[model samples]
Target: MPSSDKTPFSRRALLAGAAGLAATSVGVASWQQLRQPKARVLQARCDSYDANLVGILLEGMAAFPAMLAKARGGHVVLKPNLVEVHPDRPINTDPRFIAAAAAAFLEVGAARVTVAEGAGHTRDAEFLLERTGLDELLRPMGVPFVDLNLDEAVDVRPPANLTRLGKLPVARTVMSADLLVSMPKLKTHHWAGVTLSMKNLFGTVPGHVFGWPKNPLHWAGIPNSITDLWSAIRPSFAIVDGIVGMEGDGPIMGTAVPMGVLLMGEDLPALDAQATRLMKLRPEGVEYLRQALELGATVSKHRIELLGDVITPRPFDVIESFHRLRA
Candidate 1:
């Protein structure tokens, strides 16, 4: 069922309640198992989207046999960053990359592969898909696209409840997926420091319940809301599109940087941390990453194991205020 509460909840009330419950609600120790000394992250260098992306993705996916085994005969949902459509800017994940990912998963024996996104910026999903060329690429492949913004919702109490919203109304399609894949475009953000895998989960928050652009989450707090969402959704894997990334004042309105790489891993935090470093930024300077580390998410280089290409660090431009995040 969809959320019945149409009115937005008060941010003050939610924060106050969360402050009281956080001590007991957040279980840091339970996430300890994920804090490995070396979490495997595959970093494949693909010069452009036109390259053999499917072959590269399949090779990377093969590295994690356990995840593939689990994906076998299971429903797989690809949550790509479909923020908005812009002709000149690299605002959304490249549609070619999304199609390649879908093809790779189907080849690996996924019972079903669905492309899903609850775009925060726009309500017209069809127009976004059409404009971004995603509809054209996905249609011939028989891959169904779910507009998560309009999907049925279920109230879920986040294990961490860091935002004190008590329960989040998550899209039913994402909640029921056998395996959820977060496919985010690597980018710098005006808020949240950097938007990577974990931040990409923001699309799962049904716009029907949270309103367009998810204002309630922003009102509560972007960082806290991100961590809380991670605790609730716990996506199965991540594939970050970094072949062409955004820099400076982003999420939108940034210039593109052709970093020429694709990152894949089961550990979202570790993968994001590695991506942050590749951008020549410090993950610890990012609030959500710091909070994630506190909750036992791995961010340190010593904790991540890299495979594939050895690309040199490239500094991505950022707004004046975010200068401190530069490494």
Candidate 2:
């Protein structure tokens, strides 16, 4: 049946308008030195809804001009958050962002680059790639697709306090990458509170080896588990997609907030702390960040230099359970 348009009061139009209105509300800036397309955290308030803007934003945040000169000869591995099979609205990392990022890596002269994610909370990586639009984006690029969940596993020693999980079988793809880029989405989690770059490394290990320890990690406490994971896998770079951050009931059935921001950094803690600050949530309050800080994971703000939007912080509608009550 050919549907007749009655009055154009559809949910798609409403949501699109809602998102566009939020994006267009911000003022545009000339490509100043501070807000140039080469900033470490390129946060342009893009008015246009075109997906091509993903490429522009990626070039900006990655500071491609500078990074490419240095990364010209190495293999690059992009690890995006395909933690679930939900739509891009609030579940996984945006496919446009990932494609744009992968393209940027190629532009910068990466000998070869590949996008990989070990689907855990979700069963199939290809399903996530399709749902997130990554399949179409990577089809023409000839990038290798690796299902981490189905990869050949190699046993490795667990870090201190994590031996209960025993020797874990890690995905060979993640283990062999010369340069690992952690591409994570900005969202609150029911259990982990916030799933940033550091926590996203969970997808690197095979479920067969690390799944059992999930309970021990949580039971022992969230921070320690995260610290253990960080120690296990060290990413060379990080890119946090905050273009549309998730707020309440996040990482799954959460509401999306139009943050319109992208962050990048060489140090995981430095970038994660900056992201935590932007969320207007106390970094010290986040158990994993706090524990990472305690473990000397580079939380010192003095060491980091800002390169993008001079954004004033805004309060995230943090869940009460996640919020810490100070004495």
Q: Best by TM-score, which number?
A: 1
Q: Identify the runs in model 2 with alpha carbons over 4 angstroms from their true place.
A: 1-70, 156-167, 211-221, 325-327
The residue pairs in collision within model 2 are none
Residues forming the 10-long window of minimal summed lDDT in candidate 2: 30-39
Per-candidate count of clashing residue pairs (backbone under 3 Å): 0, 0
Backbone steric clashes in candidate 1, count: 0
The whole-model lDDT of each prediction reads 0.91, 0.69
Candidate 2, position 288, lDDT:
76
Task: Give a tens-digit lDDT track for model 1, residues 1-327.
Answer: 457465466678778878867754554433443454458899999989999999999999999988898789999999999998888899899999999999999999999999999999999999999999999999999999999999899888877788989999899999999899999999999988899999998899999999998999998899999898987898889999999999998988999999999999998989999999999999879998888887777887877889988878899998888999999
Give the TM-score of each candidate.
Answer: 0.89, 0.77
* lDDT value, residue 36 of candidate 2: 21
- Tens-digit lDDT string for candidate 2 (1-327): 336466566888889988887666543312112232221344445322245655665556455344455457777889988766655456677777777777778776788888887766766566677776778988898887677767777766646544355455567888788778888887777777777898787677676554633344566566565666676776768888888788867677788877877778776776787787777776667777766655555554444568766766666666679876111
Q: Which stretch of 10 consecutive residues in model 1 shows the poorest summed lDDT?
A: 24-33
